[model samples]
Target: MQRFRYRFDLTSLHFWIVIIIAIISQALKAASVVVPSSNCYVLDNSSRIVDFGSDLVVRFCKDVESRSQTGYVDFGRFDRFNHFVAGSGQVDFVQGFYNGDLVKCEHSYDKLGRTAQVNIICGTCPNGQCKVGVGCICNVTYESTCRVFVELAIQCEKPGPRVFKGFTVGFHPRTWEIVYDGMTQLGFERSHQEFSFATEQTHVYLYMTAIASLSTLVQKPIVKTFPDIGLEVRLSGSGAAGKPPTTLSPTALVVDWRCEKARDTPYEVNITIPVEGYEPIQFTLTKMCEFTQTQDGDATRGWAIFGVLSCIFIILSALFCCGGFIYKTRVQRQHGIDALPGMTILSACLETVSGAGQGYTRAEDINSAFANEASWERPVSAQGTRRQSERKYGAI
Candidate 1:
């Protein structure tokens, strides 16, 4: 029994020793972890964190695998302008940095405080020897490569009135490209790619708050309609009129109240932001104003002038008809068609056409007028021959 107890005690001690060793191994592995996955990496060696305000922060780290010839890590040499200095064989990463070299660096919320990286930029080391902070280390050549710059992407849940604070350079994650804040995202670039920018406040706030500061600086109005309430408004692009924005800020915009034609009616404002390789961002905005607005100028004035002219013309026509009827019946003693104003004028026109320029005369006197003509007189001999012929006919 004593021999069996000694063996059991020995086995138990060995098992505890093995368990402690495994725990120590895991802790050491975590402390020096480098690249866990292709999409993510850690700055475990000689890391330096640079906080550029709340919008962006960069962590410059030495390559974990690099065996630095010098005792210290190389963060790369920078000029006064915060640009990387390149040797003869090395390419420039500052001038055309947006074309490439900008990697996505996202700081996630976790207990480990790990920042995941989507892409990596490697630079060839100057000498054949490897340096820790030059960039990602390459195995083929003892030389090292490093990530020179990083980018952060920010997207707004609701694009409200963004004021033009100034110009800024930012990156687009979907397009995997970098651009200026005012640069148009066209073609494949129109993907609702996030653009890095700073707001008036360091923390999240309500929308349209920037308009208050920009209102005093605005010189012109976007829409012609006069609203019952006037509030400062801003937008990403120019006004709805296609005119340029009043302020120098590219995002500074003027609210176009004329979005819908129907007035005094409630409606939803549908906004669509396209996203490539994914679903688009869509939301609706409700009007804040209580009353609807119409265009300026009294529309009824034009119609009023027209109505007055019409009434005057109608009254004059009635008066003319009444006066003509009374004169024809009482003063002229006319009857039948002649007593009617319209018929009298129509008959006069017909008489003028039938008389061929001769003045008006009775229809029965037409024959008398023809007999009095000089051309109607016959010769004396022709008249005597006609009388002899008549006497012969009578004798028969």
Candidate 2:
């Protein structure tokens, strides 16, 4: 009889093994789903390529106001205008603009004094912290809030030796005085609709009434400049759409400036927009950067691997089934199950004995009381064994 062999395959084991491998690979592929965020600066694409010179932008703007020309100048708050005129006081509009009236040549002379024509420059000055050319301070308090200004210092480069006129004091700012009032000037007790921003866009439009600038080419930002050019800026801090970048640069903040590399050098354009908080709006930012395609080939590979493993598993299972069938068929053929049929030897012997000895017996004494027929079934050994012996060694 053929015997079943387990050496060729274990089908259940093969199927489970393939299944486990597929799951592990799929889990790893699923982990690649995080998006990282970054900030970008966008500038005016049209006009930002021009050369920056004087009567041009300063790195900073200092506001000088006249408290009193004769009083001790508050070297602290710029209450005294003369000190704000800076070391290059002989030059006009160097650190800031001159707004006060000039006086004619003073005749009064001290021991070593030769009378000099005295001129005054006023209107505004940064709080006394003044640098000759790099930047200035902003400490003018008007109507409860501070006015914003630029950091690029405006130096006097014109040909004449000019002296600044003194400042005009008191807060009755002229119709023109209210100009650089920043966005915080706009009441904050209001709501607005959602604004849209792209992943790496370069330009951002903010809603604030002030002057602020961020440049890609320049290091320091310019804030609160001319009020005639009204602007409003919203940063992520305000719970608005725009945000200043905290990483990547220390003082170089990420605002709404976009960098373009049209020429060999990069041109940066920064724009601050004007708006109230009640409307829905979206802005555009342009930038030059790299992008990645998100589609991955791993999933297709997973399917392919699964297919191969499944095919192997199926082939192994078929071989197992075929082996089992062949083994069972061989066992049945060798054992000859058809050869064993059950039979009663007594009946077959009786047929062959030709009524092997019809016999009559005397009745028992118990017949005197009541008749009792003697009945018996002969053992299968008796007649059938006699027939078999006759076939083998002649009748006994």
Candidate 3:
């Protein structure tokens, strides 16, 4: 019993270990964990104003990963930029980063806590230009009296009006302008949308929640955008009302977005980030969920695992029951108990006693014990009384 109990404890430990291992394996295979998605946006250049407002579709694709975590990831970078201009006159437009991205950013002193990432500019500009080529720059250039300016604005549905703010690197305030924030004494200037930028460096803040003190009051802001929104890139030629259009929206700084994971997503914003001295380019960033997902693969794996476990259980149960029965029968036989059935039972009894009782064969014992010798001797006792009496176990 002590040995059996010890064995049973060991078996129980093994069983628990197997269960834990199975559970972990299944969890890993499930791909149900919440992870960052792979969603991106295509800058696809900027489309100019031709028919009041030109229609443009931003082509996007979801790069699905091949694994069990099929469709559960979100987050991507802007990738391509292609612009089309088909206007006979100059157009008006505005372009800037989406405000939704800015407000959702969590700011803290710890670098690890920040979820946003800033891509460093490549050292090789290809051309002899600086911030105007790769970094965010807005170039607004219009004819004679029409002044152009690059502006940054953030919109949150918070209290206090509509929560609007814009920052500029060029031009002065108009008193009651939509947003009154800008860099320098008179804002920044346009350096043309080309590799040869001639504008001075100006640091303008773009609605970043960077203050550690404001962390308590500023939660993530709600941002909404319409990808189908179209803006007219109004441009007036210096000559006449009807003239060939010039590609003003510079291609020097075209930003695009793309999704790298397998998941569906939707457009988070639609903004026209304008280049300095160039037309305001219109573009949209959408969110889509379409990364590769599992097709009952987890369930299939579970079935396979269960099948193997069940077979092992059945085999063990059969072995244990058979072993117990054989052991019990062996013990009973040593205690002189009948273990055989039918004719074999009688034979088994005779053989067992014959081994103990020496000089007594099974057939001789049966014959001499039940023969007429005892019965014949019993008749002599009856003759004394002139009586006939016979019995199998008669005493003389």
- The TM-scores, one per candidate, come to 0.22, 0.17, 0.17
Ranking by TM-score: 1, 3, 2
- lDDT (Cα atoms) of all candidates against the true structure: 0.32, 0.28, 0.29
Name the candidate that leads on TM-score.
1
Candidate 2: regions farther than 4 A off: 1-307, 322-327, 330-396
- Displacement of the residue 188 alpha carbon in candidate 2, Å: 32
* Each model's total of backbone clashes: 7, 48, 66
Runs in model 1 with CA error above 4 Å? 1-92, 95-287, 294-396
For every candidate, C-alpha RMSD to the true structure in Å: 24.6, 33.2, 33.6
Off by over 4 Å in 3: 1-210, 218-292, 295-396
- Order of all candidates by lDDT, from best down to worst? 1, 3, 2
Model 1 quality (TM-score): 0.22
Best by lDDT: 1
Candidate 1 local lDDT, 1-396, one digit each (tens): 999999999999999999999998765322211111221111211221111122212344535544334465333322224222221223222211211121221121222122222222233344434444524332222211322333222211221222122111122111211211212123212222122112121111111111233333323222212232342223333322233222233332232332223334333333232222212222222343344344322467877889999889766765666566556655434444333444444344454444443454544333333333332367877655644543211133
Provide the lDDT at 320 for model 2: 62
Cα lDDT, model 2, residue 395: 28
